[model samples]
Target: MITVKAPGKLYIAGEYAVVESGFPAIIVALDQFVTATISPSDTFGSIVSKQYQENSIFWRRQGDEMVFDNRDNPFHYILSAISLTENYARETGQALGVYHLGINSELDSADGKKYGLGSSAAVTVATVKALCQFYHLPMDKSKLFKLAAIAHLSVQGNGSLGDIAASVYGGWIAYHSFDRQWLHLQRQQHSLTELLAMDWPDLKIELLTPPADLRLIIGWTGSPASTSHLVDKVAMVKAKQRGEYQTFLQDSKACLKRMVQGFRNGDLATIQTELRQNRQLLQGLGDFSHVTIETPILKKMIQIAETAGAAAKTSGAGGGDCGIVLIDRAIDSTQLLKQWAHEGIQRLNLNVHTVNDDVISKA
Candidate 1:
């Protein structure tokens, strides 16, 4: 069996601004992961993991097409991944055989909720890699990237593609889709390890979720958003203030530069300050939030985190999933966790694992 593990990613900076402008955003692989285990078969079929009480699904390939046994909406991404893999195989003359697939993912939703931690992207990355191994496709990361991207587009309709890219390649990635390219992506396998090896600079991070008894507090603005939707929304804004957007991009880039430097130097203060400023800059974008800074529960959580000495912002597609908070110093995580629980805020302990460090592969 060929096992492929993909990590869930968190966008540290350059949220909406990276939509079309080729800005640099940093993504780190969290401990949460989805694993795909595939073995050769005369037929083609995939088992969708229902780990964490999520439903398991099965799909099979008929000739050149993949058909799902269950036509539920949750299997949409799996179907999309299968379809994309089949297309890639056909175009590349690589036959994707029938295989027995078992997937196990570490992300815990406890009460059947989504955290927007790139679970879809992880699934796509895992599927693409597993299919590549199954078909013995001799493609490099770039080719794997293409197949995964097609799968992502199939489900997401549109995306920055940063999540999948980071999952596949791992570590600090600057995915600039505007130029139709990836730039300065650290592909070294040990990059994650190297990142984690650095002495964590007195900083604390909290990954929160809702009560295990309750679904994660996922707040929706009653608005469905896609990268395309926001990119189009920002188009008019950009046309009117091209100069301002350009300046924002320039400043944001500088912020990333400084943040990285601070990280390397173990300068916690600089990192904390820069993270806060970065979030402020991101919040300036109109669609960055469903409600104002003071009203929404998510934003309120950010404020509380800040008050408790954290630099925080909503993670991924900000209509709401999880808030990524940058802690200024090490605090009693257990106490903070309890505080959040009492306030009806869910707290998840997240240790952001940067790639290029440990080598974890299931082959």
Candidate 2:
């Protein structure tokens, strides 16, 4: 048996703007993960999840609004990973074999509620990693990330693949999305193996090291947000307000640039300052788009964190899920956490998972 795990991720600064080609976001890999375990099957191959009682036929709409039923599917992401990896394997002159794959996730609450910790991204990366081991394929970090990103985008079809980068590379990373338009154009002409080796324009992933005095605090709002839904809402509304959307993208790009520099220079104060700016930017964005980027509970959570002398903001596409706080190590967070507890907020016990840490650990 072979088991592999990929860590979940949170967007520390850039959120809505990261979806644009070449736009940047700062994301960190969290301790929670999705694990994929695979073993050879002599008779029939199957995909299963510990969260589901049975493996059922899966279906979803495609570009032309056509629905297709696939029996091998247990989940969209896991199925995408399996299909793409096998395609890649065949493109590389490798024969296929049957296997049974099982998935388990830690990116959710005990009751099976999502934490919005990029569960799909983690699972896709984990599935790809596990299959690589099963096939005796050698892949470096970059290659693995490219493969996982492709698989994820095939299913989700939106957003920046920064979560995929965070899962593959681990730890703090400054990610700029590649040009999906260019990718779409190339897909018509290139094989899976060819696409993996090609240069993806504007795609950048830089690992960052946090200052020693910087402290990151995460608070869960007990509500899950659909990132795709939020992104779609913004897109629909932003069409009518192109000028403001453009400015938001430029400002976000510059803010994340400074935050990345802060990490490089060990400047905790600048990092916090930029974080506050990012929060305000996101709020303005939410206001303009009329989408609840920060729900009432998340807003309350941020207000408390800021009162505690920390810079706070909604972590991902907002609506709900988790908020992140950046504070100096010298500040006392006791009162802040106490107040959060009074409001039913749960502080998550999560830390950065570095690339040196295990992206795929054997069990």
Each prediction's total of clashing residue pairs, residues at least 3 apart in sequence or on different chains, is 18, 0
Residue 102 Cα positional deviation in candidate 2, in Å, after optimal superposition: 1.0
lDDT of 2 at 241: 91
Name every residue pair that clashes in candidate 2. Answer: none
Q: Which stretches of candidate 2 lie over 4 Å from their true place?
A: 53-74, 357-363
Model 1 has how many clashing residue pairs? 18
RMSD of 1: 10.2
Least accurate 10 contiguous residues by lDDT in model 1: 208-217
Encode model 2's per-residue lDDT on 1-363: one tens digit a residue. Answer: 998888999999999999999999999999888889999999999988876444354457787685754322338888889988888878767789999999898987777777889988898899999998888776777878888888888877788999999999998999999999898899889997788888899999999999999999999998877787788899898889999999999999999999999999999989999999999999999989999998999999999999999999999999999999999999999999999999999999998887674424221
Please report, in order, the local distance difference test score of every candidate based on alpha carbons. Answer: 0.58, 0.88
